[model samples]
Target: MTVIDSATENVAHTESEGGIISWVRPKRVDVDLVIPVYNEEEELDDSVRLLASYLLGRTNEFGAPVADGTRAAFTWNIVIADNASTDFTWAIAAKLCEDFPGFIRAIHLDEKGRGRALKTAWGQSQARVVAYMDVDLSTSLANLDDLILPLLGNQADLAIGSRLLPQSRIRRSIKREFISRSYNLLLRTYCQARFHDAQCGFKALRLETARKLLPLIQDDAWFFDTELLLLAQYQGLRLREIPVRWVEDAGSTVDIFDTAVKDLQGMARTRRTLNSLSSEGTGEKENARAKTGANATAKAGAGASANPAPALLPDFRGALIPRKLSYTV
Candidate 1:
């Protein structure tokens, strides 16, 4: 397989004990797939290696065939986002980076939230497209092409794997299936979301679109995926969903009841905020109309610009400047 030496060389590597590594903007990459993990010491190494191999092995679907000794049509980077794993996960991550020089890198976060891990990785990525999947191989690797192809092909701003799609093949308990369907039904009734699945771990986004929506998302736990999709739909971002083959991972750490409660709360809060913004926008338009009589042109412009909406989230890489972050291996 053609190695991504150029992109790998641009990254900083661990040199000595207690050494500090500063984040630098590296050469642009075509795709950066982030695997977020927490205390996954047993599974991290194998999963990452498998994923790296898969990404490197892919050939261009169309165009001239990729011959041996030539770089593939796309260059990819695998980012291991470790969210405060209390085990040897960090050490394993560091070793993987060392073993697969240009193919892999790992990030350590002080917090222990899945959303937090994703936020750090996605925000720091310099790749054209950013994506994340569960460390467990519950979803077949075969479906990966479908999940990322739309984003790479520029057919959609975001792509999500949907186990709820009619064509999806799933192997899971009846209890889990019912919970998933009921949760999605709640999302549709409360938030009016269009997508079939919201909580699927397999998802991708154009870097630009991710930068816009990441800050607005407030949930830093299991509710994160749902909140993200809801805001993206509310703001009118294009989203595409593909059927995926998924199997239940018995080792899943999710607490169904707790997660369900949190998800419901997150949905309610998001709907309230969106309604408030809509109201403010309407009020501005009405005032502008009252002030101007026959000057329809001026009124329209004033109404649109007046009472600018608040920033989606506090100060999360708020500016649209170049994406850069402190790098440590």
Candidate 2:
């Protein structure tokens, strides 16, 4: 097999893998695709190896017009973020990291939320773009580049695979399809969200945007994706919705009703939070205007500067602090 090296040259895997391994062990990366897993020991090895192989091939297809009109190729890495799995998932992940060297790495978290795992792994990464997908590989691997292109081209701040899009091809049960549509309908009605799908497991974001917004996301569970999307919309960030090919995996562990109840509650809470912020912002603006009016009155004829600068909005960056995440490849 041939793999693209750091220099963008195609070389046999055995020849280039070790050299790139040495170079990337301590350097920044172009893309980091995280797979957040919890007690998925049975699927760990196959899924990780498949993803790694796909990404290795993906690098050879890059080098088009990316950010700033520069011809850049993607040097991608896979991160397996294990969320406190009681099973042998962590052991398998560590072995995969060791086997792939610089091409793959693993992080073990003490908590059991997929969101928590992604939060830590992405925060610790120095990659330009960060992404995550389900371990079941329900979404087609062919759409990976499509999900990433908008961010890479600087055309959008976030990219999401939308199984709800009209062009999306899905092989799911009628019950699941109904539930998905209903959930997205609620998002549109309650949050006034514009994106087609928020619950899709396939998603990516620019690292800068992730850093700025991940702090404000309050949910540390299944609602994490929804919360992140809602916050991004509230912040006026651009989103690219790509229609994806999806296949529902059999023997899935998710409880639809339980997750739906939690999601609805999360939606309500997010709406309240956004409304509160808006009210606070309005109050701050009014106070600033009042002070400005007072100053203008006092200096009416003293040749004061005609225009005063507007007050800056509150900074929410401190909401979540990034920890020193440990990883071993």
Estimate every model's Cα lDDT from 0 to 1. Answer: 0.74, 0.74
* Cα lDDT tens digits for candidate 2, 1-329: 12323343323243333111211234677788899888999888988877776665532212222233312247878888878889998779767866777787776777778788888878878988999999988998778878887788888888889998779999999999999999998777666667778899999999999999899988888999998987787676778888889999886888899999999999878877876766676678567666766446656523334643222233333221111111110
* Candidate maximizing TM-score: 1
TM-score of 2: 0.78
Model 1 per-residue lDDT tens digits across residues 118-153: 998898888999998999877777777777777888
RMSD per candidate (Å) reads 9.0, 10.2
Query: Which regions of candidate 1 are displaced past 4 Å?
Result: 1-25, 58-73, 294-329
